[model samples]
Target chain A: MPAKQTLTFPYSRRPALGRRRFLQGSAAVVAGLAAANCRQNLAGPPAGSGGSDGTLHIYTWANYTDDSLAAAFTELTGIPVVVDIFDSNEVMLTRLQAGGGDAYSIIYPSDYMVSEMIDLDLLTELDQSRITGLDNLKAQWQNPAYDPNNAHSVPFCWGTTGLLFNREATPGAPADWDFLWENQDELSRRITMLDDMRETLGATLKSLGYSYNSSDPEEIQAAYNRLLELRPHIAAFKTTGFENELLGGDLSVSMAYSSDAIALTLEDDRMEYIIPASGASLWTDTLAIPATAPNVDAAYQWINFMLDPEIASAAVERLFFATANQAAFDQLPADIQNNEDLYPSEAVLANSEGIVAVDTASTDLFDQLWTKVTSA
Target chain B: MTPAPSPPRPWADRFATRRWLGPVVLLGPAGVWLLLLLVLPTLLILEISLVPGLRLGQPSGGYGLGNYLQILQPVYLRVIGRSLAFAVGSTVLCLLMGFPVAYWLALMSPQRWRNLLLVGFILPLWTSSLLRAYAWAAILRPSGVLNTMLTTLGLPAQNWLNTPTAVFIGLTYSFLPYMVLILYASLEKLDTRLLEAAADLGATPSQGFWQVTVPQTLPGIAAGCLLVFISTLGDFVVPTLLGGASSMNISRLIYNQFLGPTRAWGFGSALSMVLILAVSLAIALLLRYGDKSSVSET
Candidate 1:
């Protein structure tokens, strides 16, 4: 099993050499990549695991794993943990596909990415008996579309993308996605949507009464056109750069993830987060073992460790993520439990849709349309 | 000749076989470096680019020119064109802004303060380019420093951020120092005697500058422009930060293809190849035309 999981380094063969020479060449390539800052932090686990030979490497979002969490796991199970952080699901998947995921046993990818990973046969099926806290997950998460019945991934956190605005700058509150369109005159060059192609286009699609994952060419093009109409009003397509402008009152509105918006809103009362009336893309970040994972036993142990309700609760509170574990949510402080941004009421969530993988042709069209929109 | 060689052929013939050693030693390391890093990667990219829509883990399909063909689409071509415009515009702007300052520093400024002036010009560059771009945002935004100053002066404030002009300004500002440094190096070597000769021959100062000084600094100008152009062509940060929602360029497009949702490594590689080719062409032109003295006068 571990043999199958070993990365097929892109440059595995050499015309001048045999198998041993090939391994050395590949090793050198990995070393060179590490030197170039491509995948250095991915090696989170210390060498000589258990003071011996087993190491469980986890690739996850930044701030997902801390030293205390690693120490706790090490102390509890005598199996050490090494965590490497990635900024985005796409980046994590890209590295995994590029064959840099050999040492990593566990990875965290967002909901849609989990579907893509499953399609690519990158994930290992989890044994339900081995996981202790499956029952503790909310009913909706247990049967999530991304990973039905928790077949391959464990849902860690879920959130929606919506508006993050400055209350002081905008005399009145922004109530929905249409608010930006309505105020395009005033908000011109003072509003930024997300940098994500799917989310930004999806938001436009949702506003126009289309599915976030619409495969229809007409619908996708319509979304693109709508975005182009608002192009002059948009300040920038930024991922994380809107913080200062929003705070400084230079920006009136920005589309943001609930996690980021919630974090920022907590810092200042003048900032407000709103889940649009129509809807937005709902995303979940999840953890799964890769099919190519070495040390299966360590991987199982790590999963079980994360499944403990107390540990899950701690992660939810400390990490500031919306917990999928119902038991953990019950344990959270009242203020956090009632945080509307994290756990919006069902009426608000009804309009939301999960982004799914589109067909190949549709995916290409989306890329082409996105290029046209941005480059226009 | 054979008769003469017959006397001491043993050690001489054996030792003479060592002459090829120097070239091999001199070029070996760099040859291997280029082969592994540059040549091999480019070949790999070519192979990947041939397989249209090839994601990393998926089995690669039969090869074709699909990826290259995709770039020919008007949308992508526009992106490439915009990137070229930005690069070329920035190069011209840098030359315009830098030449005068370089001229002053190298020719007119007091000798004792020359080094200090050059250091001051480069001080902002010593920090991260990202920081500088951010600083420009603060100064150029609608409610930013420039606008506030304009309003205070009862002048119409300019809405500059998130515009093409902002991108050009940022690119020019970011690359101006590199242009200045290169021009200064070339200009410092100016022949003052030649200028005096032209002036003595009844040429006015302007004519002297055009005839004597300008030609001398032509090489430096060419070198500076090429450097600025090549650097700006590859710059994603400044344009992405300063250019509004619609301002996608080749670098950002390439970035989206690679790291963005599409993950189309093939298309991304094709774009990369084009950028590399463009920069290579500019450098070739620079090498072909740049002269040591001609870089000083302007």
Candidate 2:
């Protein structure tokens, strides 16, 4: 499951072996990239990112699609699927807008990003007529707030943002966000959190009984202050690389996405993931075709292929993300169906709020306060 | 001065076009590469920097100093100060540590083994720099090898990972080879006659080294320091990987603007231009005061 850690390291292999030759090659590549970036279309996404040749290019989070899934899709559609990964929704958005995602026929954007892309006209209105098994999606996602009636996105997988803690190393099992603030002395320099701006700050915001998508300047500033207090105790704010530390007892706890956290918990019985009492951010990763996507036919086929209950169940079992398809959920093994980390109860999820596309001013404030939080 | 005509020959006839052609052929590809990659991109950044508050996916605003002036804010100034401190602190550490090894390698080590010994010193360079930083993380983390060794030796464990100290260690480790290589080059050509002469003039060993060896290696020192300074100033990996929440240097700050939650390209470009200017200034100083001899002394 480490293969699906969101921020997987890039393949840094160089043709040259010696450091000197590698440095020279890297410098050239950097310069060549700078030269290439000079010519950009900043207004909107390109007309067609290399309209589909025979292959379906999937721009998605790491671990979302494995060889089995791609091979299965290829076998069914007779068109091959190639997968590329991005750690952040914003990064995926930037890649699409920067004209670099031309070859991609599908992208897996998270809940808020789905609507943001729709607003930017970067997403194609998904053809419901061609897609199958839409009715199998859970009632909550049948008409999700981010994309009403699944106009431009299909809810593929969903999860919560919470703490993955080592029960023995930690002072006590943390049940909520306030545990860190309360045990600052005991946990000093022994805790880590997601490096994500929204998730980190949103968690802080939720700890204060405010909205995760707080638009008020004062609330955001308060969250910054609260985070600053905990800053000294945090070993690092990392998205993916804290696993080793947590396992080694260096980091007692880390705020992680449920997908990654569940894998770690399953790896070791001592490790446990818990959603804060206040609530956690609920995120749903959706499959959508870009407005500039080529090979619309292949894209639809890929979506329908994922929608199949058997395939979704297999993917959920293998990749470890909670499936949004009710049919797929029923197909999971009884133990997996009841794994709290994978799928917390409705009562636990009652307070969870899906991060939505906030207004521009609020977004700016979030970015500004986030910059202050990090740089300070 | 231009009127002397030699006997006509095919080689001489070709010289007419060859005069400009030689320079064009020699420098053309390099010039185009620089113009397209370095100069053009820099100019593009400069243009973007002049605009105020340009958001990604949004239209650029009219020309203003909003972005550059924003750097003067206390928050950003602190970031710049930290970056400068890291670069300067790492440069000093590299020189203090590298000089002694370089001196021994160049002047004291046996001639047959000097090259092999230097190669051994720089063997860490064979690995990718990202790998090197990660190795340091493994060694320096609280529950890492260093802590285990310390506890075993009845010493207090040090938690250095994800701190400014960790950043210093990472940067120094990354650039020490280059520093030693450059200093070794300059120190290799030390005029022993001058040192011998200093000794004859009733000077002690320290006095002789200060007066003779120091003066001779000053250019090398300047070159090494500036090279390390420029590289560390803009380095993104070490500080981000090892430097924790508080380690927001200029490179990371600029990265945040362009790629982080906020797509403030105007501000990112502005920050970028400032960094480029700083690096370019360091390079100008390097060319002006650095060793005129070869940098690839290895």
Candidate 3:
């Protein structure tokens, strides 16, 4: 019967290969050029070479920027803010290290990245006297582990890595990271984990009652094995593209960032976001001035503008990001302020840990394990 | 043609002295472009690939073959194998689907509408390939168009979107137009008289097609197949978007090493060199064998 099914669709056997041969032939050349182009861009000069005197270039996440934000900043200050977005911190760091990030005065790097950058001496130590609203940050962010005393970076927004699921499709509400492992059969080929190595592998480590930043080889190997067992059930290692599938009921669950999850939950009530009961990785994105910043004065102004309570509160409402500013949180509507997913209870918070940069040797171990997991 | 040698031109004769100028001027821009952008960059990648465990912005530990040796691992080998399988699979699939459409358009279709039909076949290529891959995601998902159509026809719905099958479908769909275009070009110049001659010799239509048509368009078939094979091998978008969990081909692997958390430029470069070598080999085969086949056919 299976053989009959295979024969019924020619594609089932391995579809005919010659039809689009020529198109792909040229596209292959383009892909090669693109790869080369990526390498060049990585190795190129820093971003501010365009020779715009009035423009303040900012490299940040895609979700952090909007036309209104840029326009309002430009309106308040005469300098126009040019925004460039990066999908991951590693990519941004690599570009910067390669010499392609010099054009931007302002950059948004996550907590661990800020620390890494500071250690590398790539960030400017801010003179707090020049900047206002440093005290307005939430108590936790007042002196973050990544950047104590707000020396190098200012907190932009914070969130947790967790599971987002459609209540109707999932067998039950996934309370913890173990839910995925326990219900592997039910969620088969219908779940997506984050593409980030630290987040996904860290989640597995946490499920086994180890630290999110575990460095022990045995613990790492155990986490890798646990993930390998659940590998067959995962549809893909995706971060952004799973939204449509999750909403359409095609996906039972997806591992997501709190910001992305909260945005989706707002759209559809059935989509529920949860910080796994055992624990999750807490993350904070921060705005920092790179050492090679061209317009330092304008960069300071941009930071001050973001630090303002009215602007920060308005941005959170419009963009669906949790604000790092305590003053900003106070100004938000009652319902948004009370949302537990965005601002989880203290006990839940205590359970979570921020993902810091692991030592070089451990990073290698993680990379090796990740390659094995994906390839397998 | 061996005329008496002309007297050596004097340096004073500007025109004769500068005889090499025209060719130099004409080819210089493109030659320089290929040298700088293509040749130089490839050489740099070769250099980087030799550095063992070279991460961008990190101190390099001199040159070694460690990066290339790393590729010998079974895990990495599997990625290369999967990439080859996709390339070869898609090549054969494209050839099978493209030949018939090319045949109709080239020979049987109305002569007046031939160009229009060819244009229509290539219409999908105008849109971004990334957009096209996303469209396939929409059409192949569980609640998507394919399943809806299948259920309507009382056929079983397929769960293919995040599987190897979807990768094949996306790849074949993406590359089919190029196959048809190339095949049509080959088949259009085919001699109809040979088919008639085979028939006159009491050969049946199928036999005639096998003996005459197939042999005549052998170069086109080879060219089309090689083109598809080479392209599909390095394809990143189709496999990443549609191949789901099992879609870790060499291109994506290379991407991960370079831009992903690993930042292992040495390994990435080594992988890239392998991809470049594979593409160059395919092109060489097309140039050598494809030309020979056409020459023999004529």
For residues A1-376, could you state the per-residue lDDT of candidate 1 as single tens digits? 0111112221222222123322332333233234223223333343333224665788876546767888899898877787765556776777677655465888888888889899989999998888788888898997998778889999878889999999888858987888888889988888998878789999999999899999999999999989999987888886665766676677889998887787678767888999998998899988898877777778778877777778877876766678888988888889999999889999989999988888888888887787677777
Return the interface RMSD of the candidates, in order shown, one decimal each: 17.3, 8.2, 7.5
Candidate 2 stretches greater than 4 Å from native: A1-53, B1-16, B296-298
lDDT of 2 by residue, A141-248 (tens): 999999999999999999999999988788879989999999999998888988788899999999999999888889988999999999888877776667666766
Better of 1 and 3 by DockQ: 3
TM-score of 1: 0.87
Model 3 lDDT per residue over B1-298, tens place = 7999988777757786477788788899999989998999899999999998786656888999999998999988999999999999988999999999999999999999988988999999999897788778878887777776787689998889888899999999999988887788788889999999989999999998899999888888888888889999998888888988877899888887877777788898999999999999998999876634432332
Write down the lDDT of every candidate, Cα atoms only: 0.79, 0.83, 0.84
Give the range where candidate 1 chain A is weakest over 10 consecutive residues by summed lDDT: A1-10
DockQ of 1: 0.27
Q: What DockQ results do all the predictions give, each relative to the true complex?
A: 0.27, 0.29, 0.28
Ranking by DockQ: 2, 3, 1
lDDT winner among the candidates? 3
